[model samples]
Target: MKLSVIGSGYVGLVAGTCFAEAGNHVICMDVDEKKIADLKNGIIPIYEPGLEAMLKRNVDHGKLTFTTDMKHTVHNSDIIFIAVGTPPDEDGSADLTYVLAVAKAIGQYMTHPKIVIDKSTVPVGTAALVKAEIQTQTDIDVHVVSNPEFLKEGAAIDDFMYPDRVVIGTDSDEVGETMRQLYAPFVRTGNPIIVMDIVSAELTKYAANSMLATKISFMNEMANLCHRVGADIENVRRGIASDRRIGKAFIFAGVGYGGSCFPKDVKALIHTSSKYDYNMRILTAVEDVNQDQKTILIPRILEHFGGSVKGKTIALWGLSFKPKTDDMREAPARVLIKTLHELGATLKAHDPVALEEARRLGLDKMVTLCEDNYEAIRNSDALILVTEWLEYREPDFEYMKKNMNSFAIFDGRNIYNPEKVRSKGFTYYGIGRQ
Candidate 1:
């Protein structure tokens, strides 16, 4: 199969590379000539574990290719995937300019019948919109399918190669069959290939992400209540997570959830609901909870420092949203950094991979970026574990104690045992652990 994935962003790059690895000839097309040139030269922009090696191997084997020529890519491929970014608009709806632009280009260049898959997370009915836009350009037969991606950033390759289920949305039986054939290699483990209406398929992506975000918000709220009641949220989380119906997934009490997906999808879903004059009350509260949860620890830190963080040097470990990825979009660490800076507190921050991103975001001027975790803690008043990266799980606590002017641990992810840290003659604060 010859497949062309438009927009060499995160989704497009991963999907194109994985499809090529599965024996399909893939051409990843982007309008950015510089990005295409970088890909051709084996320069990957993002850091996903195992992606660089796999992509390099596929490119070397001639299974995968990159191009800036949209006409060439569209005319040569049987399947076209619109995996472009649908960034949120000011009103919170997904900005469909990129997706629609790709669709129009496909219509203009396509010479034969093609299956166009909307792999980007778009609002419901976007498939219909894409189909309508394409039909205006050419009379060629085109089947627009709503095939949303469910790839996790850190584990995208594994998720693509071994999806729990594949959802294909198309009214035509021929289109569904074609999509199933393309995804057959991935679902060989007897996982379902769910075929549904295009609208349902588009909504599925938003619903899935919102539900996960709901879980994170609910746990964060529970953690807050636990703090007030003098109870441990971890104990409560463990108690409830044991239920068969609610088997644990995103129940950890963290600062909040942030990434390209959850924050955008939740806003988009709420915006979509509003278009129909319907209010998604639960999701609205979920969003509110999350916004506040991102900086929930600020007050605690302030109170601990006698109501002023002025002239204090705080050590922050982990700048990315979560472990194993360098993505810092809407990261809780950003909230911490901003608030601490406003309070006139100095910061020494360290992450395994996000230092370059921090520099790109101009965070270097606001905080001291350290190459190592220990270096970040040197001469700092307190250590705050923000992202819970595996490297920060266990460290030389004695050495950390000696380096810091004041020994205090604010465990945002609850990765450390409060008792163990306190045993080292240091003050310890974990989310909702009394």
Candidate 2:
């Protein structure tokens, strides 16, 4: 298959690269000439693990390419993927300007019948909207398929290489079979290729994200309650996770969930329901819980400092939303840094890969960006483990004890053992652990 993935963003780049790796000729197209140039020059914009190397290999092999010429790319490909960003609007609905723009451009320039896939996470009925938009521009029959991506940021390569299931949304069996053939290489282990209605496939992406976000909020609420009742959330999490039904995944009592997908998708789902004269009450509370959960450690920090953070220097061990990627969209560390800065507390933060993104987000001025985890702790009053990166799991406690102005460790991800930290003669504050 010859495929052209529009947008050249995270999803587009990854999907295009992976498809090319699977023997398809792929051209990743973007309107930004600079970005296209940078990609062709092997300068990846995002810091996803294993992406740059794979992209370079595919491009070197003549399997993958990058382009800014939309008409040339669209007319040359049999399958065009609308993989643009669907950012959230002010009213919380998904902003579809980019997706619709790509759709219009594809329709205008397409000379033959093509299979168009909605690889971006858009709201339900977007495929219908895309079909209608394309039909207005061209009389050619275009098959619009709703095939949402299920790739995780840090582990996108593995996820794309071995997908658990492939969902293809198309009314026609021919379109479904064509999508299945494209995805056949990834699901060699007999994982299902679920074929569903277009609307159902679009809703699946939102429903999946919302359910995961619900679990995260529920666990955070449980952790908060555990703190009040003098119980350990780790033990509670273990107890519940042992059950066959409640198998552990996102049950870790973290600060909160944040990324490009969950925050935007949850709000968009709520907004979509409102348009249909319905209220997603559970998801509304989920959003509220997550918003509060991001700054849950602020009060604890104040209590530790005797009700003030003025003149205090706090160290943050992680800045990204999670490990192995440099994405800072709606990251919990931003909430902590903003709140602590407002209270006159100076911050030194470190992440293995997110410093560049933090700098891009103007967090460098708000906090001291350090070179390493230990450097971040130098002369700090308290150390907070924000992202739970693997390197922060086991550290030289003596070095940490020697460099800090105060002996306090706030384990945001509960990756520390309370007894061991207390034995080191340092104050340890873990989420819902006594």
Candidate 3:
């Protein structure tokens, strides 16, 4: 199949590259001329693991190409995937302007019938809106299939290559058959290719994200209660996870979940429910819990410093939202830095991957970028473990003890054994652990 992914962002780039790797000729189109030029010059704009190598290989093989010309992209492809960003609006609803713009552009320039797939996570009924927009511009028939991506940013390549199941929504069997054919290669291990109504498919994306967000907040709330009751949430998590029904995945208590998907998708669902005068009470509380959870370490830091961070030099380990990627959108570390900075504390931070991204976001000025983990502890008043990177799990406590001004450790991820860390002559604080 000849495919055109109408965006050069994360989803589009990955999808176009992967599709081209699967023997499809792919043209990636975007309005940004500079970005198109960069892609043509073998420059990948994002930092995703294994993406650059795959993209370079596909480009070298003449299977994948990038362009700023929409007309050429529309006419040359049989299937056009609308993989643009659906950024959240001020009211929290997904802004569909980019998706609709691409649909109209495809309709205007398309000289033949094409299969249009909604690859971005948009609100329910967006496919209908897109179909209407496209039909208004052209008399030719277009099958607008709702096929939301289930890829995580850090592990997107693996997710695309081996999806657990592919949910393709279309009323027409013809469209469903076409989608199954496109995705069959990925699901050769007998993973399901479920075809359903367009509305159900749209809601599935929101429901999936909302459920995960709910679990994170629920665990955070549990962790908070555990702290008050002098219980360890980790033990509780283990106890509950053993139950066959509950199974552990997103049940871990941390500073809170922050990524491109959960925060925006949860808010969008809440906003969508509000439009119908329906209140998503559980989701509302979930959002509330997360907002407070992001700064859960602040009070602990204040307590350690006797209610004042003034003139305190704190060393912070990890700055990314999570680990394995440099994407810091809505990262909890930013919230911590902002809150701590307001209290007049000098922060020394270190991350294996997010240092450059942190600089790009202008967060470097707010905190000192440390060269290494032990160096981050150099003459610092206290240590805060924000992101749970693998390297920070077990460290040279002697080096930590030697370099730090104080032996107080505030672990946001509950990573360390409290007794062991305290044995190293340091005060250790972790979420829901005593």
**Per-residue alpha-carbon lDDT of candidate 1 for residues 1-434, written as tens digits (9 for 90 to 100):** 99999999878999999999899999999999999999999999888988999999999999999999999999889999999999999999999999999989888987889999999999988999998899999999999999999999888889999998888889999889989999999999899999999999999999999999999999999999999999999999999999989888889998999889999999999999999899999899999999998888898899889999998999999999988889999899999999999899999999999999999999998999999999999999999999989889988999998889998889999999888999987898888888
Candidate 3 lDDT trough over 10 residues, lowest sum = 368-377
What is the TM-score of each predicted model, taking all chains together? 0.99, 0.99, 0.97
Tens-digit lDDT track of model 2 for 23-62: 9999999999999999988999988888998999999999
Runs of candidate 1 with Cα error greater than 4 angstroms are none
Model 2 C-alpha RMSD to native: 0.8
Q: What local lDDT does model 3 show for residue 338?
A: 91
| Model 1 CA lDDT for position 63 | 95
Q: How many backbone clashes does candidate 2 have?
A: 0
What's the CA error at residue 135 for candidate 3, in Å? Answer: 2.3
Once model 2 is optimally superposed onto the true structure by TM-score, how far is the C-alpha of residue 41 displaced, in angstroms? 0.7
Candidate 3 pairs with clashing backbones: none
